[model samples]
Every structure is written in structure tokens, then in C-alpha cells.
Target: MKILIAIDGSKASGLAVKSAIGLAKAMGKPPTLVLMHADVPLMRRVAAELGTEGTRRYHQENHDHAMKSARTALKRAKLAFSEKLVVDDAGPAIAKAAKGGKFDLVVMGSHGRTALASALLGSVAAKVLSQSTVPVLIVR
Candidate 1:
């Protein structure tokens, strides 16, 4: 099975990573895991202020920090996986990756927002669920 795990450096996302590992193990076969981080695009003004090198450094640092916990979990589980960092909206980015990669499942964390709150703020998980073609396993 091929799995895509979307992480955002939150406690919930950490749990999602753990859940994906458990699911893969339960399947009784080594699955291909893709660990993905969707980075928010920097504002044009901020990028100009930071310059090319500074902007690159900033994005790299943020990606490293965001992937740290997920990487550690995968290492501890002895799971081999590829890492991807994309600068785009999280939901659409995840959906595009899942579809383009032909992954069987996409695992991600949910903030467990109330219906009203989610409707008001537009939840990433909800958006992903709506847009994804493959099955999405949401870990709260």
C-alpha cells in the first residue's frame, strides 16, 4: 500500500504520523510512505525584505522544524519514507500530491473543530476530505 501522511508540526499531526505507522504495520506489509509538509507562501513584501538567501534559509529552517517530529517517529518505527515540502495551500497541496502520486490512502490530523468553527475558519482537514480522491484517514 502507498500512504501519504501530511504533517504540520502540531501535536495532532504527530498523532497522525503515529497512526499511519500503526496502520501500515497492521497491514502486514511494508508500505511506501510519503511525508509531506505544505508550507504557507511568504508574502511578497516579506520575501523582498528578506532577500533570496534569507528567504531560502527561512523556508529551510521552518521545513526542518516541521518535519523533525515526523522524521523521528518514522526513524523509530524503522520506516523508509520520502519527504516533500511544497509552498502552497495545505489542503489543495495534499490533494494534488495524493492524486498525482497514486497513493491508496492519505492520513492527516484534524484540529477537531466544532461545525460552526470549522465553517467559519475553513478547516484544512475538511477541505482535504472534500477535495481528495483517495480515502483520507483523519486522526484527531
Candidate 2:
């Protein structure tokens, strides 16, 4: 199966990776995995608050940290697979990527967001569940 695993460098994301791995192992073939890491843009805003040089440093630091997180998640997953790191909204990007890739399934960790919080911010899992034509496996 072609599987897309969404990760955010959190413990929850690690669980999602583990679940995907288990599924792939159970299927008796290495599934096509798309490990996605999404990063929120925060540097320019920080710069506006701190000034030019401060902003530049902040941007650099954030970028490094984001990349580091992506790499760490990938390493922790310990799977050989294709990966995508997106520097925008995660939910939309994940849904778009899944659709574009023609994946059969999407596996992700649930953050256990309350109904109200989910409604207000829009959960990524919820967005994918609603938008994706393929099946989504939400691992809590």
C-alpha cells in the first residue's frame, strides 16, 4: 500500500511512524512511505518584534531547528522512505500531498484536541479525514 505518514517531531508523530511501520511489516512488503514534516513560519514576525539583525538570527535559528526536528523524526522512524518538509500550514499541505501522491492511506498521530479547540484551529487529522478520498488511520 502507498502510505503517507504525517509527522511533526512530537511524541505523537513518533507513534504515527510506529503504526505505519507496523502496518507495512504486517503487509509483508515495504509500503511506499511519505514522511512529511511541516514547519510554521515564525521568523519574520520575530524580526519585526526584535529588529533587523535579531530577526535574521531568529530566522536562521528557526530554520536550523526545523530541519533538525525533521531529521530527528526521520531517524527515529528508522525507515527508508521519501520525505517532504513543508514550511506552511501542515493540515492543508498534508492533505494536498496525499491527494497528489495518490496514496491509499494516511497515518497520523492524534493530538487529542478538544472538540472546541479542534473546531477553532481545525485539526490536521480532521482536515485530512474530511478531505481525503483515501482511508486515514489515526493513531492516538
Instruction: Please give the range of 10 consecutive residues that has the lowest summed lDDT in model 1.
Output: 21-30
How much is 37 displaced in model 1, in angstroms? 0.4
Candidate 1 backbone collisions, by pair: none
TM-score of each model, paired residue for residue: 0.95, 0.75
lDDT of 2 by residue, 1-140 (tens): 78988877667777887787778768866788877766676666664888877755654565455445545655675656776766677777788888888998989888999999999988988988887777889988
The local distance difference test score of each candidate is 0.93, 0.76
TM-score, cand. 2: 0.75
- Writing each residue's lDDT as its tens digit, candidate 1 over 62-108 gives 88999999999999999999999888899999999999999999999
